[model samples]
Target chain A: MSEPRNVKNLKDRINRIEDILASVAAGDMDARIETEIEDDLSGIEAAIDLLIDDLTDELRQREKMQKELETKLKEIQEQQRTIVQQQEDLLELSSPVSKVWDNILILPVIGTLDSQRTQIMMENLLQKIVDTGCTISILDITGVPTVDTQVANHLLKTVTSARLLGAECIISGISPAIAQTIVHLGIDLSTIRTKATLQDAMIYAMKQNKRSDEMKVLSRNALSDEKED
Target chain B: MLELAPDRNFELLGEYAIETEYDIVMARQTVRQFAKKAGMGIVDQTRITTAVSELFRNMYNYAGGGKVLIERGDVESHDALIITCIDHGPGIENLELAMSDGYTSGMGMGYGLPGTKRLVDRFEIQSKINEGTTVRIMKWK
Candidate 1:
């Protein structure tokens, strides 16, 4: 309830209301009349009406601010989601090649390696090897910058997973920094074959491939020779 | 806001190193699957995931640790993706300054807020001086 304000006349009261409104518009809500008002100045009544209108406007402004805040919040949430989806799409796109040559499958990864990408790479590689009945798998990470514990652990897991699937995973491309990081982390990759580069690993794989091929040729020759004898 | 049945589809549970910054990627993937499974439009899906990743990284790096909650709810005739991230760590003192880009908390590249804002259709941040911070983000399709 507003206090009764003392006023000399209707015109004076109206002037006071106008002054209060000016202050209110300037964001001074404390400006209010406290004096008693005399009867007969419709001007005074008009002043009172102006003060009420100003108060209503202020309330509306506050409501608008509240609405703006809510809108901002909604926007923030949508942005968070887009970031996550983009990352996943990136992961999917990064490791999409699938090919099996003979009994060996090769996955060549080229880029700045991160743990998340490594995980996806490992998962896809292992799954494909198992599905294709591949006996040997090669991972060439020559293009990768370096390996830390996280990436190293992921590689180790890939090897372990391949073993469980009855396939061997050969990791190639040991950059100097990655080798140093691995040594510093005290990670043992002795059980898993680590070649100097992807080409080296491929060469080793080819030798293994040729050795098996020669054995098969010899076995067939021996069988045919025996049949002739 | 879209009302979605609580279907916990891509579940990622693990314990990782404290200094490792890879969980940021995992969090991003989780939200991506959720948005895609919910059949959200590409723009909304992308924007929401980006904003959520920013908040998730903020928790992992600045707040030490936190969890993210995502839900789909509908309010009136609009569909929204609701993401809530809460952390019990040192809160923001100067929120206005923090929200402004280039204010690095020694975390990742300082594009956390401004970049996030660009991705989302709506964003809300509330933080106390010491009690912690809660951010609620929503995106409409």
Candidate 2:
């Protein structure tokens, strides 16, 4: 049998080990059993230290990935905001027009036209015509590289809406490739009045303006001359 | 044991096509194959496959079951491929609310529908209360 003093010492040792384990379980990796004894308790301490090391490495990797994901998400949100702001500015600039020449309004579309931009363009153009009381509108598409059915449909809707508002829309400056695409798509643009160049459409609009001006002048002069007689 | 039919237009292959929670991955692969067959470029194929995968996972988690259909449409000179996903289970009540990012009904991050819409050239959605939902997406080549 062991002496009473040795039993007390062993009990104390076990209590110390238990306290260290409790601390470790509470995520205290620094709390380790440091007794100068060659026994099973040392092995337990070594195994626990290894487990904590693995856990720390895993937690560090997780944090790094989380930071990277957050950075990427921020970049994407910034990009989306920039795109939205650009579209808004463009819409503001392109939405208003004064029909100074024979009630004709010109809308020049530039840049790569995506489906969303095309839809916004159609809405802006139609709304402008309704507000300005214009009888004629010209759409120029020289900078567009391609056209699809959805975009073409948006354009068609714009023209139809303009006609309903008692205005005529003339599409001009369609590139050769775009014309081929329109043909291959078999879209019925027979009812639309399309001009090959913006210069041609402008000249046509100016001629219509002159005719209306001449008619007005004739009516006023006839009334004055009749009053003089 | 069942007897085999003499008319054998079907050859046996290692085919494991099923519709379940785990089938989302297969559905995404099917969409990618369809896009490739429709002659999409590598970048576009990747974008479309990612978007479709998002929607397929949503279908598995939210609707529990859905249908996928792929077809080709010639828009002008462009050959556009269309994929449609339809589901009858737990139709979205408020589409606008559902489309908002960070708004989730369960565990998802809620980026599926909006992200899918952004990736495609044309997106169409038709859903009714107590009925079902149909989402049509088109990618132009």
Candidate 3:
């Protein structure tokens, strides 16, 4: 009678361990065996509990790392957006056109000239000409450090384009160094209207503007006189 | 060629691709900086930089693109800068004709090949009709 009772107790303990393992395998992290009796199976039961605890801890750590990676990716995307916005802002700020006087627009170039920037500038200047119907434009290069042959040729093309739009373009701010360099490079600048300083260019444009205004007034007067006759 | 050896400790100053007009300007600026770093005077710096600009323009306009390599070495107790321009363009059929003064091929604006030779201390150019062209210029400091 005592032997049968011990075997039944061992069977019950083994069945309880199987139930805990099944529940743990089914994603129940809290599943644990309650072993109140100390036996040879007690060591194995403790090891299974420890293994589940370590697994749960490792899963939590992986979840935290995945969340961190998602956050980092979001930050990188935000930075990329910010950089694109800044570049757009720079494009607008790099080349600015302003009407300084009647029928006169000044585009002060402040840095080195690239083809892209030149293209933008050409578009800006031409659009401003059409919008304001300005007849005179000044391209001030006082802050431009270097003017190569390519840049000079591009500027010449811009001037030609402005002429087609009924606007005259004056290139100003040829420094002493630039003048010397230009002469040494053997580039012909006689075809383009270039002034040594912005002041000189402004004065020349103002005078031309006044002369055209006078011509327009004279033409209007002559038409009225003829109509009266 | 014989004077510049590996023992002279030639440090690569820069390597650039001459593809566009803008690159010519950029290379000229960097060349000026390198010339200044090598203790060259302002005038010599300008001279060397201008020469390099011409070479860059040639490479870009003719070959559609090419490579420029700049190296600094000690030669005969003097610091020297060597610039090598390599292009796979339609090589010059006649080097003598190309080197002649004011002999522009297509455009009338170029400063001619001989003009570049006058600005440097040593100049060497080699070209094959269908292969390519290589121009090496050296300036002493």
Which segments of candidate 2 are over 4 A away from where they belong?
A1-15, A36-102, A111-119, A130-133, A148-153, B1-141
Q: What shift in Å separates residue B53 of candidate 1 from its native position after superposition?
A: 21
lDDT of 2 by residue, A105-224 (tens): 988877545445667777777787878777789888775433433345557777888898888888888866566545543455778888889888888877877887899999999999
Task: Tell me the native contact fraction for each prediction.
Answer: 0.00, 0.00, 0.04
Interface Cα RMSD, each model:
14.2, 13.5, 3.6
Relative to the unseen true structure, what is the C-alpha lDDT of residue A25 in candidate 2, on a scale of 0 to 100? 78
lDDT per residue for candidate 3 within A1-229, as digits (tens), equals: 2232222377777887788889988989898775655679878878888988998888889999999999999999999999989977877788899999999999999877766788998999999999999989999988876665556666888899999999989999987766665666666778889899999999999999899999999999999999999
Span of ten consecutive residues with least summed lDDT in model 1 chain A: A144-153
Specify the highest-TM-score model's number. 3
- Expressed as tens digits, the lDDT of each residue in B1-141 for candidate 3 is 112223456788899988887688888889889999999976677668767877887888887878888999876777799898899888888889888755678753444467577677888888876677888888999
Best by lDDT: 3
Chain A only: list TM-scores of all candidates.
Answer: 0.66, 0.68, 0.71
**Model 2, native contacts kept:** 0.00
lDDT for model 3, on a 0 to 1 scale?
0.81
| Candidate 3 residue pairs in clash (backbone atoms < 3 Å) | none
Clashes of each: 47, 0, 0
Instruction: Report how far residue B22 has shifted in candidate 2, in Å.
Output: 28
Give TM per candidate. 0.48, 0.50, 0.66
